[model samples]
Target: MFKINNLSAGIGGKTILKEISLDIKPGQVHAIMGPNGSGKSTMAGVISGNDNYEVTAGELLFDGKDIKDLDPEERACMGVFLAFQYPVSIAGVNNMVFLQASINSIRKYKGLPPLDAFDLIELIKSKMKLINMNPDLLQRGLNDGFSGGEKKRNEILQMLCLEPKLVILDETDSGLDIDAMKAVADGVNAIRDDQRSFIVVTHYQRLLDYIKPDVVHILKDGEIVMSGDYKLALKLEKEGYGWLS
Candidate 1:
């Protein structure tokens, strides 16, 4: 469903992702593990259409189309949902308002009727239950007073409502407790289908214990140094990434 061919990107003339190539197939969960400053986040940003980094070389194709020049919203409209590592808090914007607008926008782009406020409210409640989130969260300002786990669950709630084809989770497990992590993983696992895909970018092997990615990739210095199955995560945990050099 997604392909990155010899992709290279940089910020302010400094390249961060160097000739990285990857293919994410439908219904497959892929995990990318790397140390600090290894450009994993950069890869997510580039795929999400972040304008801060210029594509120095290569092509990014989504669903068999060249989307290298598409804006973030454009990519999102095409069924790409990115659960950010650090979700931004927007004051004065009700959480439900943001969720409804996002869902309506995608529906509009897909030629579906825009959901009215009533339907949106119903949808919000249903998805909140799906992610085991509190309905009270919908009444608050978007991410304003949410704890780390709340913010993460909020991201998952959005994913459930939109039902995107390709989900990019950028360090979604960063700050969760074990139970919270399991909740998040369970939510993700439930949504797995033949038409959907996941790209999980994380630092620890704990999240993998729940998600069980089809492939595990070790990214080093902006490049993929090794690729293996689930056991690779165990290796990285026991031996560390030092041997990846």
Candidate 2:
């Protein structure tokens, strides 16, 4: 459902991704593992149409059409979601209200009527239950003073509400405890279907232990040096990235 061919992207005048090529089929989970500064987040940013980066070369295609020109909101409305490595805390912004507005906006974009307050609340409560989340969180500010695990769960909550076709989780397991990580993985696993695809970028294989990927790619210096099945993640878990260089 997503394809990148000879794609090079960067910020300012520095190119981070060099001729990166990938073909992700529907219902596939592709895990990208790499060292710091390997452009994992940059690639995610570029794919989600972050304006900070510039695409100097190649194609960023979603469903065979280039998405480099689309804005981040456009991509989100088109079934693309990115969970950031560091979730921002917006003070004084009620999370429930914010989520409702965001979901209704996407619905409007799709020419669907906005859901009523009761229906929206019930839907959110149901999703929160799916991830074992505390519904009281809906009353708090958006990630305001939330623990790392809460913030990550909020991202997954958005995923459940948005129901996007392409989900990019950028280190969703970072700073999470074992139980928290499992909860997040369960939320992700619950949403997996034949039409949805995932690009899970992480520094460890432990996350893959719960959300197994169909393919694993080791990225070094902004290039994919190796690609294999789940065994690649296992090997990297046993032996670190030093062996690849």
Candidate 3:
């Protein structure tokens, strides 16, 4: 469902990704493991059409259409979701309003009618249960005054509601306690379907223990150095990224 072909992206004038190519089929889970500054997060940013990075070369195809020049909102509308490494706090926007608007935008893009208030409420409630999110948080401002774990849970809640075709999570497990981590994993797994896929970017293998990846790619410097099965994550956990390099 997602294909990156010879993709190289950078910020300012410095290139971070070097001829990076990978394919994630529908229903497959791929984990990207890399040390800091290895361009793992950059890949996520580029794929999601983050304007901060300029693509020096290559093309990205989402569902067979080139998306290299698509904006971030456009990508999200095309069933692409990025669970950010650091969840941002929108001080004034209420979480419920933000999510409902997001859903409406996506539906409009797909030529579908917007959800009614009752339908949206029911949808949010169902997704909240799936993600183990407190319904009370929905009434609050987006991420304002939320705890670290709460921010992460909120990200997962957004993911569940969006139901993206390809979900790219950048450090979703960072700053999450064991219980919170499990909740995120469960939410992700619940969304797994024949038309959905995941690309989880993480430093530690602990999160992979809960969300088992079909393939693991070890990224280094600015490229993927090695690709292996789930066992590779275990090896890296024991030996560290230094050995892989």
Candidate 4:
């Protein structure tokens, strides 16, 4: 569903990712593991069309189309979803309103009719059940005064509601307790099907225990140094990244 061919990206004239290539087919879960400053998040941002990073060389293709020049919103409208490492707080925006506007925007882009208030409410309630989210939280401002676990669960809720084809979760497991982590993983697994793909970027192997990626990639210095199956993650857990260096 997505392919990156020799993609080299940088910010402010300094290169961060060097010739990174990856292909994610439908229903595949790919996990990117790396130490700090290895450019894991940079890869996610570049794929999602963050303007801060400029693609100096190579291409990013989504659904057989080159998305290198597409804006972030355009990429999102085209079914690319990035669950932020740090979800921002919108103090005045009600969660339900924010989500409905987002869903409507995507639907409009696809030439679909907007969901009315009643339909949107029903949709939100059904998606909320998937993630075990509190219905009351939807009435509050987006991520405002939410606990760490709550914020992460909220991200999962958004993912479930949007139902994007490609999901890029950048450190969604960070700061989550075991229960919260399982809940988020369950929400992701629940939505997995033959038509959806996932790119899970995380530092630890714990999350993989639940999500169970089809491929595990070790990214270092902004490049993929090794790619293997699930056992690779188990090795990384026992032996630190030093041996790979």
List per-candidate RMSD values in Å: 0.9, 0.7, 0.8, 0.8
Q: Which lDDT values do the candidates have, in the order given?
A: 0.92, 0.94, 0.92, 0.94
C-alpha TM-scores of all predictions:
0.98, 0.98, 0.98, 0.98
Name model 4 segments beyond 4 Å from true: none
Model 2 spans with C-alpha error above 4 angstroms: none
Task: List residue ranges in candidate 3 displaced over 4 A.
Answer: none
> Would you give me the overall lDDT of model 3?
0.92
Ten consecutive residues with minimal summed lDDT in candidate 4? 124-133
Task: Kindly list the per-residue Cα lDDT of model 3 for residues 68-156, writing each as its tens digit.
Answer: 99889999999899999988999999999999999999999999999999999999899888767888899989999989988999999
Q: Put down candidate 1 lDDT per residue, 110-160, tens digits, no spaces.
A: 999999888888878877776788889998999999999999999999888
Model 2 weakest 10-residue run by lDDT: 128-137
In candidate 3, the residue pairs with backbone N, CA or C atoms under 3 Å apart (3 or more residues apart, or in different chains) clash, namely none
- Give the lowest summed-lDDT range of ten residues in model 1: 123-132
How many clashes in each structure? 0, 0, 0, 0
